[model samples]
Target: MTETVTLTVRGMSCGHCVRAVTEAIRAEDPAAEVAVDLAAGTVRAATALPRARVAALVAEEGYAVQD
Candidate 1:
């Protein structure tokens, strides 16, 4: 089953950041739907991956992701 992961992310202040995070998550799940709210510093994704794994993917992109 697919699950939506909503995480509080920090240090994403531009379009580049958004793309980077989105790409990172999508890399893990090609069909994942990713939405980044720069103003709110949050990322929401529709994916089958576990929440911790999703957070780790964002972290791998050098962004701070809250658990």
Candidate 2:
């Protein structure tokens, strides 16, 4: 089953940041659904991958994921 996780991310200021985060998640799971709320600094993704892995991928994109 797929799981939906919402992550609090910091330092996302524009469309580029949104795309970067979305790409980072999609890179891990091509079929994953990614939603970015730049104003709220949150990223919601529906994926089968574990949260830890998702967090890592987002971090790899140079953004800080709130714990």
lDDT of each: 0.92, 0.92
Error at 23, model 1, angstroms: 0.7
What TM-score does structure 2 among the candidates reach?
Answer: 0.95
Cα lDDT tens digits, model 2, 1-67, are 6999999999999999989989988887999999999999999999998999989988998999999
For model 2, the superposed segments whose C-alpha errors exceed 4 Å read none
Worst 10 residues of 2 by lDDT: 19-28
Please report, as a residue range, the 10-residue window in candidate 1 with the lowest summed lDDT.
Answer: 58-67
Q: Which stretches of candidate 1 lie over 4 Å from their true place?
A: none
- Over 1-67, each residue of candidate 1 has an lDDT whose tens digit, in order, gives 7899999998899999999999988888999999999999999999999999999988998889876
Pairs that clash in candidate 1: none
